[model samples]
Target: METLANLESFVRSADHGSFSEAARRLALTPAAVSRNVAMLERNLGVRLFHRSTRKLTLTEAGEAFRNAISGSLSDIQAAIAGAANGGGEPTGVLKVSLAPTFGTMHILPLLPAFIARYRGVRPEWHFENRQVDIIAEGYDAAIGGGFDLSPGVVARTLAPAHIIAVSSPAYLAGRKLPAGPADLAELDGIVMRSLQSGRIRHWTMRDAAGEQIPAPLREVFVFNDPAAMRRSALLGLGVAMLAVPDVIDDLESGALIRVAPRWYADAGAISIYFASRTLLPGKTRAFIDYIVDAFKQRRLAERFAGSLG
Candidate 1:
């Protein structure tokens, strides 16, 4: 009989691309993981992995088996976990990815309340600027904008990602303000570059009358991180296009001022994403419900909408 231990070892090893990595994740030694995998292969009467000194690749049979059993294994584990906890409350580590500035400014404040409500649940969150492969990296959830909807993942809209032009009061003190998107060509521009493509992004600003105009910016400084760009704008380096959520506090405090009030860009919706599983972990489920409800209660979507003054 193939035991659950053997199956878990095989799956983790395959997912991690090495027995050592799998053992690290499973909290076991490499030799033990190898033994479990060997036992599994002997029980099945077939070799599952193509092992080499430098690489371990799944064979055709192994790939087919993994595909057939992966989903069922997740469901079975979720079931067992549910039964073990008596369906009471979630008890486990919830791994999540979040954007650095937005997550800290908004979501981090909600953590105290969340911990008070679900004491059994522990959060292991990472703040970054890049998109993560949720399943492959073992992340329970991620919050961001413009993420590609990979297979077996779902998303909920948290807010509209409305982008607008901003500059520090000092930077605009002596400079003529932009009357329209086209007028921005004369001012120094702080621009964001794509991390994946290494190209500067361009924006087409839209007005209340539904007129779209391409922003003609003279790029004087470039940054890959939005937070860095915001800082640069605050330092009076140049005008930058930033999401409303990122600049709302600065705008309210008079550190940053809107350049073209009549123009904003629709960047897409900021969303929370998680795996689409039939038997989701209680921790994950609770987080999803809590966050969705919080967004609705806070009316963050309306606040994030780029409204002209």
Candidate 2:
């Protein structure tokens, strides 16, 4: 019979698409994980993964196996953990994925209070600008926009990801201001490329009366980092469409000014993502509640809407 170690190795390897990543999560060597998986395959008499130099892909049997046991494995682990803790305070690592700029500005501030409240929880957080496969990557929660809602996941809206055109006051000093979204084409633009898709994204701006205006933005600089783009705009490089939350401080302090005040692009909601489990882990539950409460107290949703003054 396959031992629990073999089962865990197989599941985590499948989720991560590589033995190295699975080993990192499992705290084992990659060779150990590989050996366990190979042993499991021999015991089961079925091939599970398609091995290649570039990437690991799941076989038909592997897909069927993953679908059958993924949720069940999560439940079993949760049960074991809960039982070990004896329904007491939540303990263990709480892994989360977050966008670098937004997480540092917004969520990182709440950590002091949250840690003070829940001493048993240890946070392992990562900051990046791409959508992560939370379950496969072994994250307890994630915060971002434009993520695919995979099975057994739930999301709560933290704020509106309203995007607005902004530039340094110095850049627009001698230039004729834009009368509408189309006028932006006359000026230089600082745009961002999607880290995941590697695509230069475009936007359709919305007027006060809710009409869509095509923004044929002209790029003066392109960056993969939003913070870098904001910094470039501050240096009088060009105008850029950025999330309102990202530039709130600059807007208030006169470092950056809105180019098209009455227009914004509705990007989507910044959401907090976690597994949808009947018996949710205590640490995960605490974080979700804490963040939602913080948003309510700060009225972040309203501020992020990017409404004109």
Give the best candidate by TM-score. 1
C-alpha displacement of 221 in model 2, angstroms?
2.2
Candidate 2 lDDT over residue span 1-309, tens digit each: 667788899998887799998999899999999999999889989999999887887899989998898787777777777888788888889999999999999899999999999899999999988888787777899998888899878899998898999999999998999988999999998998887778887789997788899887896689989999889989999999899988998998999999979999988899999887766787888889999999999988888887553
Please report how far candidate 1 places residue 28 from its true position, in Å. Answer: 1.8
- RMSD to the true structure for each prediction, in A, is 2.1, 3.0
Query: All candidates' TM-scores?
Result: 0.91, 0.86
Candidate 2, lDDT over the whole model:
0.88
Q: How many backbone clashes does candidate 1 have?
A: 0
In candidate 1, residue 102 scores what lDDT? Answer: 95
For model 1, how does the per-residue alpha-carbon lDDT over 258-287 read when each residue is reduced to its tens digit?
999889999999999998788988898899
Pick out the ten consecutive residues of candidate 2 with the lowest summed lDDT. Answer: 300-309
Which residue pairs collide, candidate 2? none
**Local error of candidate 1 at residue 23 (angstroms):** 1.5
Residue 197 of model 2: what lDDT?
Answer: 79
